[model samples]
Target: MLSLPRSRSLLAAAAIVATVATAGSLTYSLGLGLTPCELCWYQRILMYPLVAVLAYAYYTADTGIYRLVLPFCVGGAALAAYQSYLQVVAGGTCTFGGCAAVYIRPVTIPNQSLIAFCLIGLCTLGLAVRTRRDRT
Candidate 1:
């Protein structure tokens, strides 16, 4: 059975991932001189808060934070996935920053964002499932 501490550990890991992702995004924009597109900004809006929310969850051992985090995850993931489709598959374009621009080589910013959101979302989901399973 998954223990609370283990579940909380997952949240902590999620927090760490969020922190790194947020930092990476900032580095791209503020440090590397890469401007974000509209979609990127939306992903950032959803992602930036997870650092705080997941950190709080880790500190308080508040497993319920998943309720708040998952929605953001879903939204961010959806946007990232769509943007990725635009950049890689559908060949869509954005007025700002060029949605198809591949800054990281092989993966676009939206793809990177998608990966981060998915990781955090999986952690949050794991925390939720393990907590529930333990209760039963």
Candidate 2:
């Protein structure tokens, strides 16, 4: 009956998201043979940092660092959500060539990556909110 701390939960969630994202990228590169575009690269740049940041925050028990990291997670999530919609729902009509080309043909979307990132953001946000409530 041991209760885990919020920071630990958030860190675990971020790690899971990072793991899934890495796997998806590998799958696309090795299995689907799809190359990522500039926007996709940018999204990855923003996302990869969260794994480290959240891990550090959890290790240090620094809710303040978590607060800072949350914005980046949210931004990455927003980008991923938009890309997923464009690729899956919109049928790859997005202006980005990589998104349209890779996703348009089979209507394939990186839904797992999108969901993982969004969940990371949401869980971190929830943790941050709860932390703030406890402090106040």
Candidate 3:
């Protein structure tokens, strides 16, 4: 088991990842003028709050912050996964028009969001598991 400070550091790292994802998506929309699709909006909704909440929890050294982050990360991952599926299978036939899967190379917003959601979700799960272990 990691020390409390080490656990908090991991949470802070998760917060950072979430914040970067939020910034990237916001930049794609606002800075580049590329409108987002429904799944994108869903992912953003889940990603945005984590930046604030996780940061606060990290600073407060909240050992149980995983409880707060799990739901959002899971929902975000689901939306991202769905978006990714639409990109691959539907081939840009998303409900809100379409989604892009290749921007420059072969990385798209949906894919990026999925990666971020997975990372954060797993991190939170690790924290939850470790916390439970400590309690026992």
Candidate 4:
């Protein structure tokens, strides 16, 4: 069974992932010379809220919210995975203009996006597994 501390720890990890993802987006928007594609923007939308939702769930000690939050994380992961494939495997040209045009070369792999998705998925999955283990 998962202890309260353990559940909290899982939530904390999710929160950290959310925070890092948010920071990464801001960094890309500000420091890094790259504009987000439509899919990237959608992924960001999903990621940004996770920080608040997970924190809220942890603070309230309500695991029930996972039903709501997990789907968002999953959706974000799927979108990120698709974007990564398009950027890394497909090797398509980014014609969005602005900094994106300069930064994302046709040859550049979207490993960073994939990493972000993996982090989010791993954290969320950890929480779900811990919750299930606690139940059993």
The residue-level lDDT of candidate 4 at 62 comes to 67
What ranking of all candidate models by TM-score puts the best one first? 1, 3, 4, 2
Best-performing candidate as measured by TM-score? 1
* Candidate 3's TM-score: 0.91
User: 2 or 3, which is superior by TM-score?
Assistant: 3
What's the C-alpha lDDT at position 98 in model 2?
A: 60
RMSD of each: 1.8, 3.8, 1.8, 3.5
Clashes within 3 Å, all models in order: 0, 0, 0, 0
After superposition, which runs of candidate 2 have C-alpha atoms over 4 Å from their true positions? 1-4, 30-32, 88-90, 99-107
Lowest lDDT 10-mer window, candidate 3?
A: 97-106
Q: Which ten residues in a row have the lowest lDDT in candidate 2?
A: 100-109
lDDT per model, in order?
A: 0.87, 0.67, 0.83, 0.67
State the lDDT of candidate 4 residue by residue for 1-136, as single tens digits.
Answer: 5578877877787778778878877887777756677777777788788888888987987666677777886787786566555544444444332222233343232345556657766766777777788788
Q: Return whichever of 1 and 4 wins on lDDT.
A: 1
Kindly list the per-residue Cα lDDT of model 3 for residues 14-65, writing each as its tens digit.
9999889988888888987888877788788899999998899888878698
Q: After superposition, how far is residue 64 of candidate 3 from its true place, in Å?
A: 0.7
Clashing pairs in 1: none
In Å, residue 133's CA in model 3 sits off its true spot by: 1.2
lDDT of 1 by residue, 1-136 (tens): 5577788889989999999999999998899888888889999999999999999888888888889999999999999988887776556454456844755876778888999999999999998888788879
